[model samples]
Target: MINFTLDQWYGWINAFLWPFARLLAMFSVAPVFGESTAPSIPKVGLAAVIAMVVAPTLPPFPALATSSYEGLLVLAQQVFIGMALGFVIRICFSAVQTAGDFVGLQMGLSLATLYDPSTHSNTEVLARLFNILAMLVFLVFNGHLLMLDVLIRSFTALPIGHASLNPAAWMGLAELGGKIFSSGLLLALPLIAALLTLNISLGILNRAAPQLSAFSVGFPIMLISGVLLLTVVLPHTPSYLNEFYQEMLGHMARIADTFAAPRGGAN
Candidate 1:
């Protein structure tokens, strides 16, 4: 029978535990992997499997007792880093959903919402539809694999440590939140402009002849027009989403670099 010293056992545990913590935290929030309908067992199992694969490759990390204060801090840092990375990617999806919200509102479909199990909230039909399409695109493009690649690279970019993260890194993350509106607005602008023009034309017609009942016909017109526009727009989305994912991947790299830099130092 093989025997191991206490230190050897601790080394083995440390090798797996830290990486597992980070992967588990990431999978808890990252898109596709984080879906609520997915059972937690698989997420945990996947995290474990990845940690095992990654542990041997990790650079030598500080060996501290798991119960030690510094060890706890390191664990927390891993969790925070993982969550930040996941949140940045999640923002990409949020932008797409926001664009759908804009188009749905313009098409008078804002009220047509359904219970979204993934989000655990009532979501507009168009918004949900867009999210589904985006998910499909993400899968088709192997985005999930890319995301995992980024996560693995982050370990090298921001190694396991007790280093105090720069405040600027957190600030940068907060600022990144603005992408939801800016990107969303851009994506939805074409549809919004078309629908707005339709609404304006209907309003002018109603003013010219009240008997035309433009108000009565406007809903159907907007709905049908919106559907037609989506058919045109949907085909073009993969390219935009590809660019969007690339941009977020850049952000993830920056974040990891920033977090690894010493506090108050240039990253």
Candidate 2:
């Protein structure tokens, strides 16, 4: 008969629980998995499945303590690491939404808000539309799988209890945040520039004929031009989204490297 001591059982359970808790925390805030619309039971089940697959591949943990407090601390650490990784991807998606919001504002559609089920908040219609489009493109480009692969590889690169948020990593994440504005501005530039020229022309026309109400005439013109510009720009959006996704992946990889690197060296 196999003889397992109490300590041995505690160790076994701790080993499993550590990674499981971490994976659960990760999925809890991850993009699709974290969405408000996702059913909780399924999300928890998925986390368990992931933890089981990944636990054996993880680095060995220190001897488990019988105290529940130690286990909770371990669980908290894992949750933090998972949340940081998931947040990086979430920021990337925010870039697309940011661009959409800007476009909506420029096109005078800022007031058109819709209920976003995923977030359970009201967001600009254009932002929601672009977010959906970006998601589809993300799937088409195999980005979802790539992200999962990255998350898995992160364990090997920056193993649990080994990872730390370095200054360089924080700087890189900050830089990544800046890209949201840059990408959004880039996506909205054409429309903005076109509108500027159209408004200037309308101003000149109004000056030449005071009888014409610029509000009436220019409003429709602006709307039509904006719609036309969007139609023309629609085909190019996938390319932009693809580039954004690639950049996000690269940024995440760099962050992982920073975390994996020796502490207090060049970032």
- For each candidate, what is the lDDT? 0.90, 0.78
Can you tell me which runs of candidate 1 are displaced by over 4 Å? none
Taking the tens digit of each residue's C-alpha lDDT, what string does model 2 give over 92-162? 66887888898888777899899998878999998998888887898899987787778778877777666
**Top lDDT hit:** 1
Give per-candidate clash totals.
Answer: 0, 0
Q: Each candidate's root-mean-square deviation in Å?
A: 1.2, 2.1
- Candidate 1 residue pairs that clash: none
Q: After superposition, how far is residue 132 of candidate 1 from its true place, in Å?
A: 0.6
